[model samples]
Target: MSEADYSRVSPFWQIEFFYCNSYLQSHSLYAKISASESPMSEMVEVVIDSIRVHLMAPQRVVVLKQSSTERYLTIWVGPYEAEAITVALQEVEMIRPLTHDLIKNIFNSFGARITRVEIVKLQDDIFYGNIVADAGGREIHIDSRPSDAIAIAVRAHVPIMVHRSVMDAAGMEPDREVPETNAPLARQEPPPPPSSDDANRLSVFKDFLDKLDIDSPDKDKPDSP
Candidate 1:
């Protein structure tokens, strides 16, 4: 979409697209936000643990585990974004490009190399995140939902980071049993009440601006710039 044409589209979706992901509301814990100017120092690296269904509800959640740690961050995502994430992680060959795949392709076409994806803050039960990219020696940050950010990270083979404070706020201990493998984990302990979908969750496509390339795993690490 042309810049002008993009602007002409509804403004609600533009600002509200990333709002699809929310802190698993079934738990009683409250959210605490601490914004950081230096993400490298403040963020904790995490890996996709699994995508889980509520078991009893109509919701799907994407779980992020602190790398080499036991704590996990679980965020509820819409069915569409949840499926998009699963498809990317499973490397399901689609005959056509999904919304997120298209965004990665857009980044590649424009020389934007995705370095890392971060879940930066948690507030009002919402998980906020961003995509950081290197485009021609310049860095660009695009605000995104944790779910969407994660979807992109898996496709780009990048590391995912969550702010320390956010983790402290919403992160929870894993189930008693340990999975024997790193493959996607799943369980059912009766999830907290599913969150109601807000009107803003209707965004069809996350805006594709600038970004696209697969950087090395080392460069995609939390310590890398």
Candidate 2:
């Protein structure tokens, strides 16, 4: 598509990454894809897709495709990683201990706590993530899969942040606001009345002009023989 056409489309953000096999990729690629689409809408759709993909078994991989930048960020994850994220997105709780639950319990036992998750770098088509934690009164960083890190970070109430460069390269401008679809009808106010004081003043002025007789030619003319 032309650049102008692309710009006219709404901007969007690719928030989730997924993994897919060759067959799945080929089948999925046939779906409608547009650059500069609505980011908020896309995020909602991604969450819904994750739930659907994980219904039978946890997804091991997912790809985040950004049409604007034409970039595909592929993230490799384990089954547990997929299940935790997908379940969280679906707002459903599993009966047994999920992987993230076990990790959180281990951290609690060790008196270590997760502080944040950082998407620090992207190398060789692999996005690297780090988990920042407080252990022994010192901050420690552990290398982790972006998906796993995010899943744990969400459960631990830790912040998730991406590098500035990544955001700049992948982020799209937000779409413009749309007009109200169903605004209530407004009542019309009555018009204001003219001032009585101004009318009186005008009448007084006219009386003064009449007293002057400025245009009376008979009074100003010489006496006739």
Candidate 3:
């Protein structure tokens, strides 16, 4: 090739180099942003232990038990939210779907999945949480009440988390030793024997009806007594 042809080749190489540099810069920026979004200090994983309610009052609380520690976190919630959390923990179906159920359905319809829930803050006796969801390539962080976040997390079978700072501030240990027998067991009931009154009620009723029948030709009319 001639010297002019060599100049043409140089421009092509320059363009290729520029494209590669631009791509690397864009990738590095994305990495930095992702790292910033998710810090190195990981949150502690937790599970919903129970929902408690005070008698004859609207006040309710949801208890979260740390999976990796012996600490617990309690967050007070409203009656409706408490019910939602209880329903999810019991794996019970409601006659009408509750708010959390509706949200789960909406997420499914949009092909989105809740990946995690984080109890990120507790300030002035109030708690805050976030729902991390994945919709295909996009991940979203939604601000939510701790109760609602937990309720949805149970239904989604997602990991529930507490910020290390939050745990350090509010985590509590059980006041009493937990009994090993307190663990859940399969419920069993004694079998009702065939001789039980309830088991013979139907046959007893049939016998009484046969004795009272008066239309049979061979019936003894009680000796006219």
Q: Which candidate comes out best when scored by TM-score?
A: 1
Model 2 spans > 4 angstroms off: 1-80, 174-225
| Full ranking by lDDT | 1, 3, 2
Best by lDDT: 1
Query: How many clashing pairs per prediction, in order?
Result: 6, 7, 0
lDDT of 3 by residue, 7-55 (tens): 7777778688678889997765312222213332668888876565533
TM for every model, in the order presented, reads 0.62, 0.44, 0.59
CA lDDT of each prediction against the hidden true structure: 0.70, 0.53, 0.69
What are the clashing pairs of model 2?
A: 10-36, 12-39, 18-62, 18-63, 19-61, 19-62, 19-63
Q: Which prediction has more favorable lDDT, 1 or 3?
A: 1
Q: Is candidate 1 or candidate 3 better by TM-score?
A: 1
| TM-score for candidate 2, residues paired by index | 0.44
